[model samples]
Target chain A: MKYGIAYFPSKQIQDEVNSYRKRYDSHYALIPPHLTLKESFTADDAEIESLIPELKKIANETDPFNITINKVSSFAPISNTIYLKINPSPELQTLFDKLHSGKFSDDADHPFVPHITLAQDLVDQEYSDVFGSLKMKKYDLGDEVDRFQLLYQLDNGSWTVYETFVFGKEFV
Target chain B: MKYGIAYFPSKQIQDEVNSYRKRYDSHYALIPPHLTLKESFTADDAEIESLIPELKKIANETDPFNITINKVSSFAPISNTIYLKINPSPELQTLFDKLHSGKFSDDADHPFVPHITLAQDLVDQEYSDVFGSLKMKKYDLGDEVDRFQLLYQLDNGSWTVYETFVFGKEFV
Candidate 1:
């Protein structure tokens, strides 16, 4: 089975973001609006099951934080993927490092960049159509990520929720 | 603020189980029925924020699994806590082990054992009253755990949901 991990935005915000995605994101209906943490990887049932306790422990040890979307960007040459640019934070880098350290490493062929994907699998013209329309717009938005979910694609090619883990505590 | 992580039964089951708690458990109204993954711990806002990403990654790595409860059990001497006994499963043990490692280690002084809390902080008579009644009843029930949440203790001393995380994926 193929599985992935990500931080999903709140339902209300996601619904709004997805409205834009319907125009550009092919997987919009297949997956919710989220920032990829660990891209999809193949794992057997036993191997995946074995990782739970450790994941829960890791979750309990970490804390909730915020991310800001500053602008629209993309990987133009390598992959015609357009996304929201996140203003960098040390905490986010630490989190990415921590998650990719041991058993839960990144498996995506592309370099990992923290982004909220607006569109993917596009041709140059398609990318330009959306990027051109969005490039000049300012995106000063943010969200507090307190929890994240694990997702998997079924035989029918639909993404399904497999599990969710909340951050360790409520800091506010 | 104090915080905890637990697996709560479905609403229907929780409602029925809570009725029993109302008669026996003093904290019935204060909290719902749950199997705690992490006991309450104290941490600052920044520390708690740093844990969210790791927690989400952990949740994603772990797959959903089933748990069964066949009988009632307790820690009678050290504490007057009565709980539903969970059948032994390597998955559960692994989950516990994973959750207790490193920075997010279990802070509670009590030994960690997997059981759903039915009643706790009881006086001698209260303990005997409920324990004797419950011990005789066989509880042949099970549930699939696909998600868990972080809980916080409000200033009013009531527990509230801080955030919820679901299991990674379902492969059929």
Candidate 2:
């Protein structure tokens, strides 16, 4: 029911670093959409609240998070899960895997899919046109991610950062 | 927020499939924990109800899905994404990539780490003492997957299989 803050990428401060390039230059790899690895699940208020401290602990311990948001990705199979992928830097993805791989149920058979889902709704609407035109552009996640924020769904269903942790126990 | 369904394998299933002595052994990937991709996505009860018919239509139009689960793969920096290294037969990954690409978002830089997340919550946790001890084993994704089920979540935090469709038409 509870979600962790470690999975979030929106925590990075917005600037030239996190902002996507509207103009297409070059250097763009063939980017793909964020793929969903599971079915949809729900979290209760209590569940969200329960994760705050734990999330804080990990964010504190995991230091020097280097990040770069390459491009957003999505998945819309005919009748399957869909999501927005937040492409983290390879180093950051490795750190995340080291932190996460054993904690959940599916440890042995699969690995992580570095993404931050911008899922605000239940339906997977077809956006053939949007996907058709969007071009991949370079975007920096951050030179160095000093902190990570915990995002929780507000009563109105808007996501607000619930807590934050700075690496090295400064905020812990 | 509403979420969608994708299959990420759990540790429970991985341990089972890895013990096979020969490639001829029939194996199956464990269903990973379903994730809630959307944060504040909408789907009214009525809307969900009416959408099932449309969903059924989409299912009917979708290509047949056949997949195979294969060797263990991990991500670096972090296991946020898992690579299904050595790949598998059935060409499921290709199908998953093609049918769902760009449906969730327009910008994604990371490749689909093919493994399911071992843990749902990535936190301050210990890594496995005997991790990869069973890498000597192999598994299968099962012989046939006629179709995936359609499911939805209620406001009260419960889930239901809304409808079912087949590889081409009818259900398994």
Candidate 3:
């Protein structure tokens, strides 16, 4: 009954990111490398089915946008989530804004900080091991955000895509 | 060819806002009191036509969110636009993001700051007058955002709605 919206990276990039996530995060096997839009909300099958038309409309109108992953960063000294910092971009922000508005609205109380999580909830040794290895690691991961997906988690603590909405056609 | 996405307020609020805008803004009569999502973009008729389905989808998926106008503010020193300040709401931000991300993407290069413009390009005295009057006046103008619209401007500098998209049914 709970669902969220997100953008999954390409296979090549996902594989590389997941490899790191597996070592650092316990939930790595439960999910994939993706950026979340709407975090989580409860909904039934009928409700989700009704939303397809609207989701399609949003996808159709949206143009593909490119995301650039500049470097690895951490929410340290406060939170334990290590993430890939997304470069400042107008397009990404715009896309983020839309996903949270309208019928897809959710409780996003915190300020929008655009990042893709690489690892989280690490202890001292684990954090040191991951950060030590990743501190010197610089990434220039780039990809076109052509589609955003709706995903849901089962009782078994696994996430799966409910639907994938592609950006609408570009007007010539 | 040039278009903007916006949300129109109630007639009562629109009238009140427009009264102030007309006195301080030269272009007040040119448009109504509305919050803009996508500022402006050039598109041919055919291109816009093709975007209807996508726009509809977005509109359908979006549930209407209420907007609360807490006070008046200005974009001063940097810009000369005076407007009503929108209280920070996740719904508004989400709606704004969806509008710009889909096929309806436009040339909004600036950061997304949600405000309803009352006056712009005012003379020094005019700016001072409007700012002085508004700074003392508190506002609590609130309205439900049932729908968002796509609007186009005419050659004579007037505007008209090309389409109106309503939010999907809300589950009880």
Candidate 4:
């Protein structure tokens, strides 16, 4: 089975993202609007089962953090994937590092760019048309994320939550 | 740190359980109304980190199951713990066995008896007074539980969710 980790934004953020995704993104139905924390990785039943404890430890050591989406951005020459750019924070970087280390040490294909995809798989003409208008729009949006979900890809290509890890220590 | 696993009922069920817990259970504020799936066991940070994967496997193999609460019951001789008795199903038993086997093989002090603790640590007279009335009343309440939470104890002797595992296979 294929597994990945992600932070699902609030309903308000999802609704906003979906408004654009429904028109442009082909993958809108496969998964909800989410900030991809870790890219997709393959794991058998035994492999994923053993990784749960480590995931929990990472969650426990980290505190809930805020994310701000100040602007819309795109990967132009690379892929033409447009996204709502998330402002970076030390806490978010630490979490990204933790997942990409040790048991979860799978190097990302691209450098860490925190984003929620708004539209993707566009041709040259449509990509420019969408990116040009979106870049000028301000999106001063943010939310406090307390948890992240470990998701599994269904046979139908849709993704569903396998587990959720909440951030923060039990003790002070 | 100490960790345990449990299934938390819906808010309606929790509210009903809390009605009695607030008046009787000495450990009421420490945790919410829950069905204990695994007893408290000690683990260091590293130990817990390593155990997460197996927990995920158990969750993945199981399916969401239903529980019917039919009557009030008590562990009179064993302990004065009065509870809302849960009628068991095969799925629930399978999950219990999975947790007790292999890496999680810590023998339970008592055989599994699924119940949501309403009142505990009662004196002899109080135990009889509470159990007497509660046993006579019928509770035809039930709920479908799709997830179980791994909880940790806090410094203030309270419990908080560390992670949540949802049940079901990703593919048919």
Best by DockQ: 4
lDDT of 2: 0.37
* lDDT tens digits, residue span B16-50, model 1: 56656666777664556677888888766687676
Between prediction 3 and prediction 4, which has the larger TM-score? 4
Indicate the residue-level lDDT of A87 in model 4: 96
In terms of docking quality, model 1 is incorrect
The per-residue C-alpha lDDT of model 1 at residue B126 equals: 79
| lDDT of prediction 3 | 0.73
Clashing pairs in 4: A49-B53, A49-B54, A50-B53, A51-B53, A52-B52, A52-B53, A53-B52, A53-B53
Q: Which candidate gets the maximum TM-score versus the true structure?
A: 4
How do the residues B77-100 of candidate 4 rate in per-residue lDDT, one tens digit apiece? Answer: 989999999897778888888889
TM-score of chain A of each: 0.89, 0.50, 0.90, 0.95
Query: What lDDT tens digits, residue by residue, belong to model 2 across residues B1-172?
Result: 2434333223233334333211211111111122111222345557555554543454455675434556645453464232234344344554344334333222224544444333312222322321243344465543343444443433333332223333444211
Q: List ranges where model 4 is wrong by over 4 Å.
A: A1-163, A166-172, B169-172
For model 1, the superposed segments whose C-alpha errors exceed 4 Å read A106-110, A169-172, B1-172
lDDT of 3 by residue, B26-128 (tens): 6664556778888878788799877767776776677888889888899898777899998888988887777777576645687788888888989888898
Off by over 4 Å in 2: A1-172, B7-42, B45-54, B62-65, B80-110, B117-125, B128-130, B134-136, B153-159, B170-172
| Proportion of true contacts reproduced by candidate 4 | 0.16
B-chain TM-score, every candidate?
A: 0.89, 0.50, 0.92, 0.95
**Please, what is the TM-score per model?**
0.51, 0.32, 0.49, 0.54
Looking at candidate 3 chain B, the ten consecutive residues that score lowest on lDDT are B163-172
